[model samples]
Target: MSEITPDLVRHLGVLARIQLSDEEVERLTGQLDAIVDNIAKVSEVATPEVAATSHPIPLSNVFRSDVPGDMLSLDEVLQNAPDAADGRFRVTAILGEEQ
Candidate 1:
């Protein structure tokens, strides 16, 4: 079993830029020790034959086929625009720049 010392916890807190109280450090030591122990157990069970995976079940891309379709004309698209110029939609300059 791996042991988590108070000094190690204090170092981790300093590296993470967190101010941890003495009580918090003591409490976190036990929690981190338990976590490390559990990870060690998992490592014991994991073998070279067992492939590492991110998920328990298999996954595949679920995407539709990319087929070209008829597109709207410029006139049909610009009909609803509040402002249009040069066959395109025009809006007020947000950055106070001339169009």
Candidate 2:
């Protein structure tokens, strides 16, 4: 098993652009090491004969019928909007332009 050292944790933190203290790195390294060991144990028991199952129950295409029905008009759809402009709902610009 690959050892998760403080240096490895520090490198990961740098890649993710996160600031972490030495104490945090030590704590995280121990936790990550245990988790990796646990996953290794689980992988050892997995066999090719058994089909991989994501959930406890078998799931298939659970879908609803796509039947067209009477729909609301454009005006009716936008009627409940607090601020509507043209034919759609108006929202504030996320990026402010420089004056």
Candidate 3:
């Protein structure tokens, strides 16, 4: 079991630039010890035969093929716009300021 003392917690708090109270230090010491113990248990079960992965299940790309075909012309695209100027969509000036 990992031994996390109050002194160790206090020193860690200083290093992290955190101001921990006596009660907080005492509480964190036990919590930190438990976390370290759990990690140690996991390490014990991990073997060279087992592979490390970010996810439990295998993943594959689910995207369609990138094929470019049939694009609309500038006139066809601007035909549906409410307002257009200089071959571009015209929008109201934001921030209540004059353009």
Which ten-residue region of model 1 has the weakest summed lDDT? 90-99
Give the least accurate 10-residue stretch of model 2, judged by summed lDDT.
90-99
Q: What is the C-alpha lDDT profile of model 3 across 21-89, one tens digit per residue? A: 999998999999999898988899888988888999999999989999899999999999999999999
Query: CA lDDT of 38 in candidate 3?
Result: 89
Tens-place lDDT per residue, model 2, 1-99, is 568888999999999999999899989999989998999888998889878889999888879889999999999999999999999899988886873
Deviating ranges (above 4 Å) for candidate 2: 61-99
Write the candidate numbers in order of decreasing lDDT. 1, 3, 2
In candidate 1, what are the lDDT values of residues 26-76, reduced to their tens digit? 999999999999998899989999899999999999998999899999999
Cα displacement (angstroms), candidate 2, residue 79, comes to 17
Error of 1 at 10 (Å): 2.4
- Candidate 3 least-lDDT 10 residues: 90-99
